[model samples]
Target: MASTNAPIYDELFNVLFVIGTILFIGMTALVIYSLIQFRRKPGEEGDGLPIEDNLPLEIFWTAVPAVVILFVGLYSYDIYDRMGGMQILSNDMHSHHSISSQEKVWGGIGSSKQESNTSRDFPINVELTAMQFAFLFNYPKGEIISGELHVPVGQPITMRMESKDVIHAFWVPEFRLKQDVIPGQPTILNFTPTRTGRYPIICAELCGPYHGGMRSTVVVEEPEEYDAWFKKNSKQTEVEL
Candidate 1:
């Protein structure tokens, strides 16, 4: 896992896999047992028994599924809450006065409830725009624009993203973070990259005929390296401006 959030998702997946495997094996065993124990006799082919309703069996089956589903629902909800999925968007998102012309605020995976209680520095904010076949990243602080994303390791990153034309998705599998970029609605994605390496950024949603080509790279680097890169890029941006 390259990010802190990946383990939470992986744990959820593991739990689901274990539950599914147990159910599959148990059901297969029951089928095999029924075939052997309740099959027709060698030469006697008559209506053996007329069983109306097995009340206990019915209750067992229904209760088992219900309990299992309830457990899953609660478990999934907890995971989502931990990932900060329960953080609702602001009510004024649709109001034109609340946001600037260049950006519209939409809620997404933010800091978890637990994280919200702790005192921490603000995350590095970057604006991203997804077009038909490209992802553009802009660092508002430095007035720098880049085709690829660059960030320091071990720090929180908040991506404010939107789509220029159609719906697209920003997905970084290693970090276990994905968010849709809707044309008129901006969204945010928060994560702390723990590994210092290059990771692929893919558009998980199909937006256009060339959706497959909408790809970019996120370069996670040491704090010093990132600072140097940022300074260099910002200077160039200044010259261009």
Candidate 2:
């Protein structure tokens, strides 16, 4: 299984592919038919038929495309909203709110519509620092620092990311999540890992030399396993520090 929102992205992609295929085939067929049907025969003359436009035909062609566009626009917006796009936008707008405001605004992808309606458990907070050659994962709770990220399966996570030098992107294909990590600009990524396995974390942006070497892994395991690993790593990190 992929992340919770992966299926949503897949659904949208499938819809678009189908729509594009239909339009391509239909338009190609029409072009071929018009070319052959209107081609001059051996004795064909000029101005064979000065046909005027039919109101119903014109209306039909215009209405068909208008309806298709409307449907596509609405469906795309719905998918975006379901994937927490609106929530992210809202958080960004609220980030500029006055300091006196009590509520905190978080950016990047937040909870989906269904997740937002119900009560939610506290997400696992992880700080990600992206540099030229690597990504560092910092667990603030235990003061742990590691090159690879480790998390418990089926648990919500909120990753706060920033860049130490230049702009970078944190992208996990299975999770269908990508966010920019820019210098002096903090960003957030929220998701719930549904599968218990390891996924590669890649820097989708073109950083500097050896950008391909800037890669990591995220291990998602059961709660017990994650707890044990976290404890052991945190202790080791403390000793090294």
Query: Which candidate achieves the best TM-score against the true structure?
Result: 1
Candidate 1, lDDT over the whole model: 0.81
lDDT of 2 by residue, 96-166 (tens): 22212443434556466324322433466688999998999987766679999998887777777889999
- State which candidate has the highest lDDT: 1
Name the runs in model 1 displaced over 4 angstroms.
89-104, 113-121, 236-241
Candidate 1: C-alpha RMSD to true structure equals 4.3
What TM-score, to 2 decimals, does candidate 1 have?
Answer: 0.85
**lDDT at position 153, candidate 1:** 88
Which window of 10 residues has the lowest lDDT sum in candidate 1? 113-122
lDDT of every predicted structure (CA atoms): 0.81, 0.78
